[model samples]
Target: MAESNIHTLVHKETITLFPVDYRISRHAIFLINRNNIDSPLPLLSEIMRSKGFKVTTDQEKADYIMRITSYVTMPTNKNDQALPYSAEFLLSMREKLPVIKPLLVQSGDSPGEQMKATAKLVHNSNQGILGSDASNIISLGSTFGGGAGGLIAGAAASVIDTTASIFSRNSIREGLAGFEFSMTKNSGFLNQVSGLNVYAASATPEKPEALLDAAIGRAAAEMERD
Candidate 1:
């Protein structure tokens, strides 16, 4: 692993809080209740910008008025019809703390030509959170930030087999992410769900918040496709 690449894993992040009053920017967007310092909101904003959904105040001109909420669901067990294949993952990499990357971004059918489009897609490997489960939603707070994140990363790094040193990016994609959206208002095709629904992680062993984040990212990436 190149030293330069390692920097991607750990870098500086300024926890910018959403405007308590209203989000006003040249790009119109109204983000509601996504205040978690470490969360899908930050990830969502990144996705919206990448997809041409400008972020700003002046809901009058906004393409999408999105309200994001994080929810926790019932736990899963071996017998519970195994989570959708997309939500499960396992990683065995030489670099234990390699920076986790975002979902593979791709432009999809835009809600409208003006609001729907995506930028270049770039990323490494990790989970299968692409268009997966619903009811088995989970919380991601521990995976991305707290101690569990640290522990999970550390474990993957050390899981390398000593005898069979050939660890060719052993990975299991986690697609255990889903959302429920409903639009309240629509003047143009650009106006999407009145509410953007996204959940956290399940109680599984390796619920990378990135998956949930990626789930949100993937949805936003493909949201606008005409």
Candidate 2:
């Protein structure tokens, strides 16, 4: 009798979201790597908790998993110069239990005078519920869009959504939104990153408790069906 590797197999699901543009994505990756140099595990664990999901560093124990990545791309006019570069982001979700149906969301926008505009648009489009104080999270800068002036403008929120659907099996929905306001003298980094130089910042749910409840409800409903 063969060992029951099948029964031992811990069924799981995973989703990965990454930035679309090469330059911005690379820079964002650098920032994440740099900031998380001390301990990446904790960061991942926190993110999972925020989304109302359990985290196990061990891959074998994971029943469902999701990953998200984000990057910005320069928007070009006929002149081939930066106008309002579009921020391109991608998400991939995978599941092993029940079935799998991967989903994707792509969004672009002309940087607005206020980060809230862009943030709200992206967040709402991605089906993210915003907090009552969401407006305080984003800070828009003049050069946020794109221009000769290379500066780290205001601050923006980073929202990534990767959760299973309550109504359908093997279905997934994901989204991400952020804005930056401020000016930095790191022209070299901006030039090296390529594409639009978008600022990236960490985010906390405006109403964490509400979001958690929603996430739990959805997850429980899905589990019941399974």
Candidate 3:
């Protein structure tokens, strides 16, 4: 089939996709560089092994070389205590997709890019969940009166609701949330390819493991499905 670049947004789901007609079985030797605490190579390695790929430590001897390009893009200052600019970073990512996208169209089998493999991960966290108070405002306005003032108040409340929802509903849920993974590959020669998938879920700071488990579980499911 023609080269493909796919982006999927899933809630509480980790998506794993192979080439259009390919399954997760050709991974004979696989390796991903573990560079940080947030790195998930071990989790993925387990899944890959289950699908028949042998994990290798010697990169020069392996056929699949996985590189993680994951990073935290917000709250550069650990003490900033404010919400990191996730929305801004996402906007920037959207802009850069055109340049970064071409690299992800290739599959692990051919990796048309003829380049090595790399995956980009973007993560961010905030104090806690942010919820909209517009509905509460509407309720208060309605309870107060019923004449022109009520009509005017209702209209104003509706507008407020819409605006507030826009900011509160941008998918940046509270407490340790991560959003996307853009996988790019180079053939180490000429052509290149990549695949992108967006995953959504958040866990409380005190329950970080919950998020990790959720991701691993979703990944396994996606691997099986695709």
Candidate 4:
């Protein structure tokens, strides 16, 4: 098959949390919790610190406040029978952040599977959100900071390549749906921000958390490039 013909089945979306020009320092505090999943605050703190971000307890010294929460949403769709339950993972970053990313992982067929899938989906979603946040800070800086037009062009090309890769893997795309990712090019970060939503089917293996860890590791490795 041609390289262009290959795709990964994984679905993803990213909202512009900080405007492309939003000023963000290298300090943050995680005030994250969840009604469904275990506390990810410690894990997030460690991850941020490993990326050279100063994890502060003081809100005054933090550049951003990261909040993550997960919950089950009752059925709003008529045909969502096999996956009636919506396991949602929401990530917010700002002074009074709102849900910038609302990732949905559908439940399984039976009630038992649905509950298990919901937990997996929530965990994985949290993982992906944190990992993406780390990498995005650098990517946004390169595109929005003080770079040439080529910088943005390169970023756009990268986005296209990523989408191609995801769609190439049939397995990754399998059992996944309602996936959406986008950002505003001209929005200022000082006032309003954008959100991304990643929706997937069956909250099973290779959960979104795995995807997140991989992305975050890559991004953390590149922090020194800044």
Candidate 5:
């Protein structure tokens, strides 16, 4: 009995987020370079690796790409304005590949309690959006600061919603809610001026390894059905 040459080539991808507001450059720099400083890129990569997938930082080497866009706000208005925040994720898989499919996920939120509200919208609207259940979805990990927290929360919620929307425009189970938890309390003048600085990326989806596998697996299964 000779060993079978059965190997799975898990394609690579990137995840990135970008803030639209130019006023918060300082906060964005701190979030990326300092504060909870470490880059989210490595975190995502490690997650993907745990799922038996190859992770890469080079776009040229990747099979797919995931981009995230987020907005954070620190209120300067006395009316307790509900600052608007959003997260846009674009997951692109190889068009010609047999085991993978491309996808795009986007989400947004307003200020106040709505910022924390985590109701999976797109999934609830239809079926075939997610990978059969909540467990199939990817958890990007936690972030600090109210603004950042809100942005991450909004994005996560949006991903769930968009995932559902992609599968079935009318899914029953709204993916998951309130997944984003804060690591620090809002304080200091810096917090006031800083608010939440938005950060986004357009990288290969090699990070957050679990997410990459789950997404790829889902796409693969969907492709088989087609």
Candidate 6:
């Protein structure tokens, strides 16, 4: 698939795609440089594991490959540009899959700041549970009027009766308090890939865990979409 090359502070897009069953066959591998990291592959694997994706060291068995590219922009006082040390994670899927999306793209000036942001992104993206077990919770409440319109027209209804009914309604509302619903949706698609499917981006501050988790979670969310 063709990729985009647009550069923005933070880039994100959900390309059109058909639904695919991620549970049946989901496997991925990571291709990250170790020079700038201290034994991060295992941590990356664990993070992906949390998203319900199979982490494989065998590149051939991977359904998709994750590659991280990083760049540093030196402080150019003349151009009024601040130092930008950032990393980008890319997902390359094998075969023609239904949907492949950039769930998140994050950038930061320092590794530590990036890690914190990455943790938050992962927590949000994985907000509800993953897979079919995913869902959300919402609570609702309502009030009743006890005057004019509160009573039925042409009925022998008295204020006492109306009040009783209102009380009953209030009781029902109380019982239904803290009601929740599912927030999960069928996702996992990408437009023709080029090079601009960035998910989350940050500036100034940086962190390591955040970058790792963001990249891993993004790829896993795409594959694990229900």
lDDT of 2 by residue, 12-61 (tens): 22221222332221121111211122323343234335544454554444
Candidate scoring better on TM-score of 1 and 4: 1
| Per-residue lDDT value at 182 in model 2 | 16
Give the alpha carbon lDDT tens digit for every residue of 112-215 in model 3: 21111111111211112211101111111211122211112225655346324433533221222222332323236532322233232321122222222333
| RMSD of each predicted structure | 15.3, 20.3, 18.7, 18.9, 19.4, 22.6
Residue 111 C-alpha lDDT in model 6: 32
Error of 2 at 144 (Å): 18
What candidate 2 gets wrong by more than 4 Å, as runs, is 1-54, 60-64, 68-208
Instruction: Flag the better candidate by lDDT, 3 or 4.
Output: 4
lDDT (Cα, 0-100) at 217 in candidate 5: 37
How much is 43 displaced in model 2, in angstroms? 7.5
**Which prediction has more favorable TM-score, 2 or 3?**
3
Report the C-alpha lDDT of model 4 over 1-226, residue by residue, as the tens digit: 0222111122223434544432224434434332223444555455446656455665565554444331222121112211111122211121221111122243345423433344343333322455333111111112211211122222565444532332232111122222122223232364443333333222333333333333333333333332
TM-score of each predicted structure versus truth: 0.32, 0.22, 0.35, 0.31, 0.22, 0.30
Worst 10-residue lDDT window, candidate 5 = 174-183
**What ranges in model 3 sit over 4 Å off?**
1-18, 28-54, 69-174, 177-188, 202-206
Best candidate per lDDT, number?
Answer: 4
Assess each prediction's global lDDT (C-alpha) against the native: 0.29, 0.23, 0.29, 0.31, 0.25, 0.29
Flag regions of model 5 displaced more than 4 Å: 1-40, 68-226
Candidate 5 lDDT, 26-129, residue by residue in tens: 12111121212233545434433443335456545443233321222212112222121211111221121121111112335222112123223321332443
**What is the Cα root-mean-square deviation between model 4 and the actual structure?**
18.9
The reply for model 4, stretches above 4 Å from the true place, is: 1-17, 21-27, 34-40, 70-191, 194-212, 218-226
